[model samples]
Target chain A: MLDAVIIVLRETLEASLLVSFLFVYSNHFSVNKKWMFLALVSGIAFAVLVALQLSEISDLYDGTGQEVLFITVLLALSLLIQWINFIVIMPNYLKSNQQLLKILFSSIIVLAISLEGAEIIVFFQSSLANDNHFHANLLGSILGLGIGISAGAVSYYLLNQLANTGVIICLFLLVVVSAGMASQAVSYLMQADFIESGYPVWNTNTLIDERSVIGQLLYALIGYEATPSFTQVIVYFSYVLIPSASFIYFKIFSVRKN
Target chain B: MVLSKTGSSVKAKRLFLIHLTMLVIGIFSVDASAKRLTIEIEIKNHFFIPDKIEIPANTKIKLIVHNRDSSSEEFESYELNREKLIMGERKANIFIGPLAAGEYPFFGEFNQKTAQGWIIVK
Candidate 1:
């Protein structure tokens, strides 16, 4: 039962946190709310498709297909975040460019939800098939989902309370999330042998063992890894630095020009 | 800068295409090099058949994980930075290594207490 709770909570929290961020972005822009309908329908539908075909997927690309697909999704989300950041910073630069925003928001939701939702779909499929823990697992699943959604909701409300500042915070968060995704993508690439799995840059498992509950939560929330390779560290920092530095540089240069 | 007055869709589209090309190139390049070792680990009754396995340090390794039980389990490892879902009676391939000497722990997320194991890199 506890296993079920933890699995669902982690998966749900990961997807919902992304959704919550996009939701706030949508509110700030006054973009159409119709995207939720599209995202839900497509996300769940694709999740079911992915879950059903997962075994086949694992078999492709000399059995590195899973990592390949995972890498693509992570990188895609990161790229979309870059676009979203630009939109957030220059909302009215192109008044009629709301279409692009709509597309970005919708794509992020679909990709984020479907990737995480596939795991949940697989969990439920497995759970329903097993009679021994059906009742307990079902209860845990519900509890996990409730808590996960509630956490996302609370975060949404918190950012909303901050009003204008919330958008700024969200912009920062989106950047951080992209950095995390980049790190995760690098890990997958290393696993696939597309990139070398060099020696780890550092290890901090003693401080907060990655297997611990907090570690897992942090992993889901921020892509935390205690023993990251040198490649992963370099890529992660590049992500965090490049966008932020570019944004600040642009801001300072524009102020001077004005 | 994409939203700047001088921002052009052609450049954005080109940048997107470059990223896509690099990704596609990565996919095709998987065959450019071959791993030196392949390891098999089976999960029967929610436990890794060989709960402890060893490999040489700094060597890329391919892992074929076969699930023999009637339940699903997630193959997760913090040290190895790998995770995959293996359905009942199905198998998944997990590639790892080229690492420094040490022990890397992994577990089945669905049955953590019982489904634990380690990779000894030496």
Candidate 2:
């Protein structure tokens, strides 16, 4: 429930931000509100339909297909987080108010929100996999969604209040955290044998069990692995640490004027 | 901000009423026949119409399980000791006892993906 809530909140907030930004932009250009709302609703509806389609597809292939789908989603999510970091999050640190950047952010936000809707479907389907009470599960999901939307609204309001400097720093940090967790999730799917094998670097399960609460939290947040294959660890580090260090370095030294 | 204008107040009120009416309709429709519980089970591509279910205690339910997929699904709850084999575009009926309020899990034995649902006797 908590995991679902967090994912929903993050995804919804990203979508809300995009929509609000578009509203503001539309006002500047005097775009038709009716058309704008229609487009937005259609996008959301499409996302929901895709999610339902994926759930149905998962049910067709036996358990193996579902496992493969999970792996694919994790990989896609990881790549998306990285792409967002490289495109929107990083460039913001170097310049202010670039029109192209704004357009890119808006587009990415729409894409992310639509995909997030699909992810929500997957999450709910998985939750119901073990149980069959449609009413109960539906009630719980509705409650979760309500909370998520509230959180998203609050986060958007908060983001608007923060100073530009703070927003920049916080946004960058958020991207780093999201990227780290995404990378770890992908590595986990790979290790689970849902995906084809990559090289194994080391095994450190003896030192720390990944199943422990603290260990799992670390793994979710920072891509910590006690026993990771060589390629997994390298991929994790390269995706997170390298870009993170470079981002910090560039922010502090290279882009001093901005 | 433009929506806050006086002229738009009427439009806003109308919109609010429409939304309210829809909400009320949705809620009331759900409670239409208290005894005739209209439960909807989603049949997706690869999974059971419903993976799990919960019910109120001692309630007679008209279990409306719909398999919206091409593949057939079976709804079986071991605790309830009941199984309903529902084929594609079909539904099965099982008159459950006045079960006590608790969690009873069910699933599809053949297609584990499509076979799962539960009854909550609350």
Candidate 3:
């Protein structure tokens, strides 16, 4: 139940952030109200279509196909997220008090619908798979989404007050969280066999079983595996390390040069 | 520097038309190519089949997932923003992007041991 809530919250929060960004952008740009409404409707419709399609497609395959499908979706999502980070989020983070409202509106329709929509659909499927009640999952998802959106909006407003100091901190935190999420996603795919050669690097399950509460929390936050395979360990370390190293390099060298 | 005002206005009009045409074409192509790619996924006795996949760039895929086991499973990928719930002996479909070349991974939220897969776009 708790896990379900977290899943829902995370998914919904992303969607809410997109929507909030759109709202602010539209208002700042003074875009025609009709066009803004059209964009919102389009985004919602697109999300529904994607969600329906996912459920329908999941019905088609039996074993290997299913695994492949899951991996494919995860990879696609990860890429999309990276794109957003590079294109939208990062730009906003780097600038100081420069309202990116115009840029935000440019791709708001597509980005808002696709990313958030997909997240919600995935959360529902995962919760249901975990033996959760349908009603409970639905409720949790809606609640989480609400909270997430509220948090994002509030945070955005707060950052405006604290200026660059708050913005930089939040941006850094977001990067770390996103990296963690990316690693976990990759690990899950490796375990699924949709990817090849993911052997355990070492079997630490004997030392600390992942079934415990602490183990589960570690798994949730840091992509911890008690008996991590060779591929899993390599992927996790590379995912975190490569990005962190790049970030450090950019901070120490690139920024200083500028 | 020597151009007449009428000639310059005509040139401007032509440029605007070209820009408009390009925008229209871009929108049309994106819409036309949004077709979903279908992939078949399996679950048996509570395990995922194949467990990993590599997708090339610019392919939109639809996953057809079937659950043969008595228990339900969820195929989830945060990166792809995709998830599908399969009840025991039931099937479902999840449509994912015209993904660029990269890696996106997923798994079964419930039967973690059995359901796992990856989208590798090259």
Candidate 4:
């Protein structure tokens, strides 16, 4: 049951952080909350489908196909959001483009949160179905959900303050988080040998083990890996660079043109 | 100088693309071979027996995780990005890399503290 709490907490906190970030952003942009709520509903519905088809999905592509699908979807969504943010949102931010941006960004959040939520639900259901610790597991999960949601609320408040001071900081955080997810997606592919992963550049296990409390938080936040391969490092940096560069270019050069 | 530079750069780009394509094919062929490499791992008392495993670089290997514990366990690895929930007293078959030489870490998600191991590819 303790283990159940720990696992649920980890997955829940990740999804919660994404939700809170979206919430704050939408509030600032004056977008209707209804659209976001609808996205959440749709995402949950999709997750149910994923959970139901888990076995079939797991069996595809010599048993590595599920990871392939996950990585592809995450990478695609990250790229799509980043591309849209640069090409559409940044330039038109001061103007009232809230409606379109609201829908676009909300869908991105839905994709991330729903996939994460699906995994948690699947984990919970499996554990419940197999084990006799029904009471303990249920209690643990409730506690985990409470803690995770509170953490998200706190972070949202702090980040909202930061946004008030400077929107660029928020933008940087958003882009960095997206890049981190992309790097993680690449690591999944590497684990399955869907992509080439070179030798480890270094191991920081002694200094900061990824299994530690702080390490897990950092992993969720910034995609920190204690031992990263050369390919992962390259992917991480390129993911961070390409979108950020586009942002800077559009911010500076496009504004100049205006 | 500009013409030669552009020509060389274009050639380099094409060469890199060719290498990437070959890498993809190499991985596919490695998977298709009839020779199946199998490794057995046992989980007892929330610990992985023979925690450190080594396999040849660039080959598909099958891993059989036998969980002796009466409680459920999830074989999870951030490095390997593979997670499987094996019900207590059950077993799971996990297929891993034709990988580049590196160390990959995995743990039992239900018992992370006691159940840790590594896969070393050489």
Candidate with the greatest DockQ versus the true structure: 1
For model 2, how does the per-residue alpha-carbon lDDT over A227-248 read when each residue is reduced to its tens digit?
A: 4545555566677676677668
* Top lDDT model: 1
Cα lDDT of model 2 by residue, B1-122, tens digit: 55657769889889999999999998788656434444567666646445556666665454556666554454554344343344455444444444556666666543454445666666
Reference-based lDDT, each prediction: 0.83, 0.52, 0.56, 0.74
Candidate 4 Cα deviation (angstroms), residue A223:
1.1
lDDT of 1 by residue, A200-242 (tens): 7888999988879888778877778898888888888887787
**Of 1 and 2, which scores higher on DockQ?**
1
For residues A197-216, what per-residue lDDT tens digits would candidate 4 score against the true structure?
A: 45568878788887789888
Tens-place lDDT digits, model 1, residues B61-81? 888889998777889887788
Model 3: per-residue Cα lDDT over A1-258, one tens digit each: 444566666555554554444444334334444554566677667766666565455434443344455455445444443343343233335344233333434345554555466556655665565453667777767776677767668855765455555544444443444444455455545433334323334656566656565654444334456644455456556555655565576667656777
What are the C-alpha RMSDs, in order, of all predicted structures? 8.2, 21.8, 13.0, 6.3
Error of 4 at A56 (Å): 1.9
TM-score of chain A of 4: 0.87
Put down candidate 4 lDDT per residue, B1-122, tens digits, no spaces: 45698899999999999999999999789757635589999999779998999999887777988878766577998666567766566666776776678888899886677899999999
Q: Model 1 off-target regions past 4 Å? A: A91-94, B1-35
